[model samples]
Target: MSFFFAALCRTLSPRKEEDVAEDYLSRDAELKVKSQTALHNSHDSVKLIKFADDTTLIGLISNNDESAYRREVDRLVSWCSGNNLELNAQKTVEMIVDFRKSTVPPPPPSVMDSPITSVESFRFLGTTITQDLKWEPTISSLIKKAQQRMYFLRQLRKAKLPAQMLVQFYTAIIESILTSSITVWFAGATVRDKQRLQRIVRSAEEVIGRSLPSLQDLVDSAFYGRANSLTCAGGKSPAEVANTACSHADALNVFRHRCNGKKTCELNSPVFEQDPCSDTFKYMETSYSCVPATHRVVCEHSMAYLNCAAGKVIKVLGADFGRRDHTTCAFRRQKSEVEKIDCTNDAPFVAEKCDGKNTCELRASQAVVGDSCSNTSLYLEYAYICTDA
Candidate 1:
């Protein structure tokens, strides 16, 4: 019976595999057909690029005509409806990259009867691009993201993880985020911006308990070394050399291959659908040069009471909710005794409760953030950064 069952399974496996392949092919063909039809239905002047479900439509207008842009948006909305794909209005934004000086203001474009919000800076494919083509926003975002990952690095260090393994984790988690689209944007970055990025690397080096070369130094060495047929002479291993080679080649090749001649192009990170480098450690970075957009920055100091002001949202960047030697935002039970709650992981909860509101009052209590520890007194401690809604 066991022999007969084994033989039966073998006989059925090929047919099942063929059926699965046929199903996948049919679904792929159907998706392609729908996507093509959507593109075909769009205005002739509008350019569309579809990757999976993400679609971007680009339209060129002279002297702010905007008629062609609106028509394309309306057509796209209709197409999506026909194909059962609902257009997400909240995610839809319009950015006009106009370099030419004009006496009159440009007309605003609308989609699906709603006015599309115009943004000075918007994130596309992990890179923050501004209309005026400055790298400051991207750099700021990168630093902010890297700082969060540094928390994990600190945790690992405290746990006394192996140095080699910590380095691997840093490269995989922290470094990857910092360099996601470096190739696209690194050239346009200002000196100060580069210095700011290097500072983060320096912090990483400190965390790993080893000194590594600055990002600029690495880039320069990679570029110069590749230009000259020279091997990087050091105690460096083959893996290090290969990593540097891939990083060097990636930036130059991406710029030369993708953005060299194009007047206007969408430079997406993860440049190719497939891995371009054979080494598992190597990945693509992307950024673009564009015109600067108009924005305002407001700075304020928050002491015991924190307010987000009007038309702004509060984002808690980092927080340490515990008792300290100093008296800051103290929660007192008796005159001598103080109560505190460590609610580090309750960031999301606080955000959910307080974000989008004009003001919020926080009470450090078990009810608010649950009792993390008993007997030892504690207080709520946090730091927040606010941004315009």
Candidate 2:
């Protein structure tokens, strides 16, 4: 293809653009393409010809009508040097040698960064990424990132009070070296382990995959009414899961302070607590909502939440929306079937009675337990990040 294109282009020019392009372009790729173009500002008589090498040449000859074909012929004659345009086969070798000898690639241009006028100090490129964001680990951005993480955790807490050990969240990694001093500052977290950190990372990945379902998954799961059940932050026991989540959150806060960043205060909110809400339920098969990834925990029955009494979800303790009736339950009731809800209400659904017909069509598989021992898929993604800094 290279030979073909070059040959084609060569036949179009007495002196191919490739031969003069480097010199005119200063060996810059952007300039190379630009220099090779026949960018005429206005219509004019121009010399356009093909060469034996199949290279094309286009050049301004004359704009005047009188000089039309004459100017083009003159340009070609000049390209031929002393030789005539109608050259016989005998002089072809001599003409080729002359053209090759005259052609040489242009040198690359010299580019320098902003000049250093002062010898004493230099203005370095700002280490701060003032532009976009990265989905992976990096050194500089910490607090901005931590707060982003905190926002996500809070959202999980709002949706799933007793979020499972593997509830997912966005993550970022910082070098431990930057935070080693900070971990020591926290007396309790001195015995950190690398393997433990890896486990935490795996947990975080599961959480993200669940929350943000891809476009294809969203279409297949939502529009098609397919059962892609995945529970993130919901688990067999809320108490055990909350404890594990807190440890990871605490480790991240420690990592930040060591980097001379803001010290995140201890959180006593239900977000970091075991038994965060008044009620508990054994999760059946949990499917995602809204998007393919937003987790929707499906309890087996409309039985009152362990935390509810008098037909109302208890309020003294934080009330979560799970474990309610299939229709007209507290959460759904607040919507009035069509009205807008100012605050989230407890939402539950009643499944058609189970007569051993296996009517429960929840896709339950990953890490299952509880009365759901027979139905497996009760699993949630864990989203997290750690920095050595």
Flag regions of model 2 displaced more than 4 Å: 1-140, 170-389
RMSD of each: 25.4, 27.5
TM-score of each: 0.46, 0.15
Candidate 2 residue-wise lDDT, 1-389, digit = tens: 00000001112233444555766577654532222233221225332434333222222222223234334433433443322122222211100111133433222111121111211111112122111221112222333344345555556655754434224233223212223222222222223333233333344445433443322232222111111233334444554333321122242222222111112112222322333223322122211212111122333242321221233321111112212222323353434432321112221111111112222223222223222222221221111112121
TM-score of candidate 1 on Cα atoms, chains taken together: 0.46
* Residues 107-179 of candidate 1: C-alpha lDDT, one tens digit per residue: 4555556666766766666677677778798888888988999999999999999988888888888787777
Minimum summed lDDT over a 10-residue window in model 1 is located at 1-10
Total clashing pairs for each candidate? 14, 45
Cα-lDDT of candidate 1: 0.55
Residue 240, candidate 1: Cα error in Å is 22
